[model samples]
Target: MATPDAPPTPATHPSADDVPIDKSTPDAEPPPELPENARARRYVILSFWLVVVLLGLPLWWKTTSIYRAPLPLRDMQSWADGRACRAEFPLLVEVEAPELSDPEHLIKSAQHALDDANDFSAHHLRLRLASPKLTDSTGNNAEENVAATLKLLPGPARSSHSYQLSNVSREIELFYSPSYNPSSSASSASLSLFVANTLQEIFAEEQQMISHLLSTSTPAPSSASGDSTSGSSKVNHAEIARKMSRILRYSPTYHLTFSLFTGSGTPTSWEIEDAIDEYLQPLLGALSGISNFTIDSQIQFYASPSDNVVPEWQPDGEPAEGEPQRGKWVLKKQDLSSFINSAEWPLASITSYPTINFIIYVPADELTPLSISGSATNAFLLPQWGGVKILNLPVEKIDGERKTHLTREDLKSSLDTFAGQLMSLLGAPAHPSSLPIRLDSLTRQRSAELLTSASSTLGSLYRLTLALPSISIPTSVSTAVSSTLESLQNACQELKQGRVGGEGGALAEGRNAAAQAERAFFEKSMVGQVYFPEEHKVAVYLPLMGPVGVPLVMSAVKELANFIKGWKASRVAKA
Candidate 1:
């Protein structure tokens, strides 16, 4: 707009290089050259290195390092190697021969026979004489010290010998002819021989069970084949495998789920509360000493079996004309694994211990008169799980509506079978016909099992940590490991002392220790993010650290070169 008064403005701005410098103003003399501060340059280089060493390195380590908990690695390894503990069972047997002139002689002779008969070094028998005064005691005074009591009674003539075991007590009465008394001159007593044979027979099952457990728990020594007890200790591998497959793992507590599943809506109610109280409570009460059990019952309507109807079958021989064309609806042994769809039946209550499912399915009207294997038993056992029973109407009602309710009396037999299945699934042995005695044996077996399991878990944890050096371990893992070791030591000591009473707290300690070891070994934090690759880390930090490191490295190299040049010049001048 003011182009007439002033020189015409340039159409476009001129670049800095294109602009002309005015010569009218003489360039001011350059300021006096400042002295080069070699010290300052050196300080800059040193400061960069100091920051890297003092700050960067420590920060990287703090972020990338794995947290490892302190564990008794040596002790755990020793335990895994089977050097720390050797399991032993010293059973005490009391002989009661009040009729004998001297019971002490009989006990000594029997003990000698037992010692000769016993081949396994870990398990042995000790015989002792019972006091005559204990005979009149109202309560079992000697139950604490004796696994079993041998009582000798005088029998009538013509009866050589017979034995009777008291169902109510731990006493076994041996009826012998009055003339069979031990003679002072005879080196081997007949009475002692009888007692030894009976004892050997009575304990045969327990000995076999113990031998199987020991064989599976520890590594077999090379010298075992040369030892005299090797045959006695050796058990069939297939049998041991079968036993391990059938029984559930040891736990401090067990949850028992009793469910009534019906194909129709009418049979929705059950007298389950009363039935459990009347039929199953007694057994649970008896097992309370060894383990805690929580019972829950429910009824489900419109439920069906895995297969609704029977399939056609071809027998080995030719089919008969009169035989039913439809094959029996048999749940084959192989199909038992898929009998219960676990995903469909989520647990109602969350529990630490494993859930044992007991199912009673009532079929639809069309599939009534249900029978398992077309036999008297309508129940079958699921290995490591509970039992299943198919309930059929007591009165065959072809047209009538399905039974709407199940009374306590109607559920008694099925519940009884469920109780037996419960025992089997828990790994309890069926022997001695005494519930208390069987449970006691189960306690000892469970303790040994838990101890072995815990040791093996600890070994696995050690190996895992060694293999993956970058995995994180929390402080809780350390505390759990310590507790597990301490509890295992205490359990081992208790076993060594032959203190296997469930109420004495030894068995529970072993179970708890095993659980803790499992928890620590499988800690969530340690296993997660263990497989992150190094390439991914480079991809994440390359953009940020690349530019930052370049200038620092170049400056350091330049400084080093100058310093080296100065050093050589000084050396030459000195020469």
Candidate 2:
């Protein structure tokens, strides 16, 4: 009864009115007081920056920087500018005249005349008389060293003095009249004047070639392109450029391939061995001083032109009448480049030297003598490759048809053409006409070219290093560069001294330097260094750094903002 009565009272207690609402606003509490060591927060920010600048920056630089060898940049530039050395070719002319009474005096007079006649001092010619004993001992070797051997033969019946150069040897047979007798005078010999003029004429071409080479190699303007009237020696720049474009670069050895490509299966063999030994060996021997030659011949039967052969514009008998010419097939100028299918061609040898292809194409039936596009040439030369000769059956055929086999005598003309082509491709000068003299010119020219090329390569390498600072360089590259520079210096010094003597002189030094420089410039390790950009590096490092870098940056920025706020508050308090 009592509990029921209490529950009834509790329910009626709050029903009459609600509790009163509070109307007064409470005062805003002040921000919590700043920490005592709050100002020291700047130290943490400074420490982060210090670590990034001093340690992190250095670590990144050490990891990314490239290795560049210390090169003699000044020396390389001087060499490229042709200031390190002035090239000079000093030719030694040892006169061997057993017929003369006083050979020394005559040679001296001739030398003086030659000096007066020549205005080019860089190409200096010195004359010396060979002793009787030396001449006998230096039989074949004497011709190798000397420019020419003058064999003075007195022809009493001859009205005037005449000289003839031996094609096989460097011998000049001077048939003089009775008037040009050097034995008659000791001081002034009339024969000396004749000999001097003759010698000048013989050496004029060589002098021109040397002058051209020197001018081209150095910074000096080429005499070939200058006024011919201004200089005593003149060279044709256009002709030289054309000839050089056709000639192959200098090599220590050459692989000469003599290939007989015939459409007919009948002519399966040839006497190529005897033909080469008889016609080409002597020339190769003459050129042995400058370069070595390894020759091989092959006979390929059932051979035909490539499928890409472009027919002649108009057949011989067509004359624009649209009538087909019978039994006439030829290669046009445009077809010359594709004539030799290099993909199917056999290698001459497994050697470092370049292979020169010399082909003699024999047709199955009597085809008209093949001619080049622009001219009616029986033989054509392919620039930097080789030469080609079309062999047509002789008018008087064997048994009413073409011969089955070719003998040495039958292939004489074609072989001669190949020899001439080989000489031309070897950069032998046409002037002076003498094979020996031309070979000498080739040697000097090749030496000059090598020196210039080596110096240029050194300069290029130095510039490349400076341009690409991020490219990694290996120790092998550095070693090769050092070797190249040393060899180049040696070559320059030898050139300055004019040491163009019997081998091991400026010429040989230049060749060595060129080889070394080429090797250094074309180093595989040096070329393999790929460049990576800053963006690429950042992308690679982003994942590793994102988690750490964002928090550090945000903390630093928040600390900076708090410091600014505290500084402003402190200033307000002071005011």
Candidate 3:
């Protein structure tokens, strides 16, 4: 039998092609006929597809859609378009002189003089006259933002001159010779000429500043490309942008931090309160027109550069020469911005209240000579933020205090330096010469900048809404956007009418706009929608799909073949 089986394999060794093809019958078993209710398979598939498309789609959309507030997009776009608001700083400057042939004519002469001398269009200084015999209600209102006052004193003397700001409330005192009065036109006097020129000169810086802001913020005409005016503006911008960037955008409340850090422990507690009052508060009060300021002071101990530094000399000078060298530690210039030992220092204290923490870092005593790592640029500004100063505290055990914490007396000089740095960082405009005028300029700039930034953010949000299909928006975002737009409008109105104050109204508006913009753009729900994908849904349902598909497909095939065969049979019978 074994020989027979072997012989059978030898007999034919049928090739794969030689095996009979099972065409008529299925390999294992034939399919049963369609059940009477087989059409139920189609109903099942239809139900699943309907659920996925209708109920499932609605549920997914309900769960995933982001809350978008109905922002007045047209209004916002108009604001961005420079159409919603026209910022005109109508400065009401009153020029007064009790003695004159005709008060109105005298006023006319000064007004003409002002118009002649003025160049910057936006910051036009207009003149109003105060009655010589004035009372508390009408006597110039010195509290208001008066650029300057020209008083014609009955000087049995010669010419015109500015009185020392410490003595007089008036800015200029003109000594008229009586012959200095004009008859017909009411135009006469070298004193008047001097007053005109002097007044113009006083506001020159302010004028340029306002112009700089206008040109930068205003949108250029669509076809106004390659124009000399446009090119000239950009050239001016290159210079102006530097100064503007240095200045902080207006904040309603600025946190003034005075920190004393030295490489060693000699000076610990600084005369921060006394020194601030002496050198900083007056300036801060003047700046109140642009923003309110909160004063804070702190001291850090055992702070040093995280990395080792090796100094290199440049053509200019040595690398980090002063106090950076501590405990054989030397850092390069590149590492200076991050030089603060944030891990150890108590830089973060107040939980909120828009606190700007200005850190004063004094390295440990072991590394005595501290210096920046590279070529000298000892102090650098972190934009819209605080500053850093490296003060070398001399090693001394003073008043039973063993370590190098700054003392009030020891910090006198350091506080002065900090005061100077603080003013610079706050972006007080160089011109308008007076602290008050500079602060006003800062206010206007902040309002405009904040409005522009916030408007741009809204535009971006609108674009993002169009772009991100899966992202969900919440109602808070819309509410914030609305609030921002309202704040921007209100601030714009304040600035245009010269309602700007050292109290910082415009600056406050700008701050609100900026804060709101940040909130709107960075709503937590707007980002991070990466949990599920369409292909994944397809994958999860595939198991059910495979099983459900078999019956429906078989039913369809059998139905189609039967229909065709029945039609053919009917045709044959008719023939």
Candidate 4:
């Protein structure tokens, strides 16, 4: 649209207006250069910018925010409702009769006797008929080693008596009577009742244990297992709660550190190897399903405890050298949290594996009557950590009674205590007094607790994503959650259906559920994003945008005004 003869400046163009020459004309909105409605226009533009900065900016910020994954808040809360699973322990009772050709009848008779005598539904006995033709090799040597074994000899001089197994220490007894023969069809009262009653008496301790566990979680027999608890006995839920609180969350491999702390170097070594072989190894072997135990023992001497100079042993930081050393580094309740003496102690496990430490602190004779100042409580539990026991040993032993340094022999009693305590911390149920029975209770309890913990954790993960609005959600987390939920359902079903692990064949389903739940809760992708503050975001975005944006916006406004003016003039002409 160019013409060859046209001049570039329109102002220079001349028309037939030679007579009309105006010399005093002003342009560009007068000298001050103010446009029409300049103040109102400026205010309008300013108001628009203000709206964009305030309303629009914040809207964009919020709209493009991160996507947080959904969580199952209600499900999580329900899991924590403390009604998830009530641990029920039923003891496995084995009754054997070597003389009887048909042991099945005796087993049935004994079971009947036990059922009649039992009042607690949760802690009843399941009798196993000893195979009349037992393959001697199949008998658990571990069991045989810890209990008394009886030899059944057929005779008219009939009397049943239990005898210690010279080799295996199995709890087996011999019964005799020439005229007594029970038929396979018989399911009635006879000498079997006597035997059953005797068996019950032997396992009285086990019954009390089941009662204890039941009382902790749910409805109880009021009195069962002859535990010295009365029929009107109320559940010590708090005590049970304490037990649950103290127990270590379930782990497949439980590291048991047996540490021997002494103030002096006198008892540096112990016959622990032999004692473990004889007394402890078999019990641990029996608990294969409940847990895999790794034991490491250390004998520490001259191990000085931190002290406070004050006679009351109140804490006051480091004691000044000559000022009565006020409290002599006395430990307080708060101090237990960091009191592991990690620097000096051989704190790490030998295998470099994940472990739960069980500490035994034997203070020096110089620091007698040691306890946490003010807390007044001697033994205390550290959450998710390990347990501690402080033993006060006599300075010397006069006769067979202990009076001196802790010999390998004296350690037997202490190790026994520690071992027992370890089982408890491991959440082993107290019941049926039978070692087998106890082991079985521990297995079930662990499965139940693990199941709950994992499910609860999964539920937590479900809720967390919902609470934090600006978090990135990945498919891995979803997959993990799904897998864990599936596994938990399987485990809970197994528990309800009574298909969970039994003695050698521990509940595989429940274990899987627990493992899956833990995996889900600890999923790596869930915690990948770190939170950035809002101010930091503003700082990052404002630098480049503020300067560059101003000119671009002004240019847009001018172009828009010119287009509007031309369009309005065209419309007016048409009107």
Best by lDDT: 1
Query: lDDT of model 3 at residue 349?
Result: 43
Best-matching candidate per TM-score: 1
Per-candidate TM-scores read: 0.80, 0.77, 0.68, 0.57
Candidate 1 per-residue lDDT over residues 191-291, each given as its tens digit: 77778888777666566666666566643211122232243544465775676688888766789888988767757688998999999998888777777
Error of 2 at 73 (Å): 0.9
Candidate closer to the true structure by lDDT (higher is better), 1 or 4: 1
Superior by TM-score: candidate 1 or candidate 2: 1
Ranking by lDDT: 1, 2, 3, 4
| lDDT values for all models | 0.72, 0.71, 0.59, 0.56
Candidate 3 lDDT over 148-169, as tens digits, reads 4566665555633443221223
Instruction: Tell me model 2's lDDT, rounded to 2 decimals.
Output: 0.71
What is the C-alpha lDDT profile of model 2 across 411-516, one tens digit per residue? 8988889888988898777766667677767777777777777887877777777777777777776777677667666765665554543467666877777888
Q: What would the TM-score be for candidate 1 when compared with the true structure?
A: 0.80
Could you arrange the candidates by TM-score from highest to lowest? Answer: 1, 2, 3, 4
User: Quick one: how many clashes does candidate 3 have?
Assistant: 43
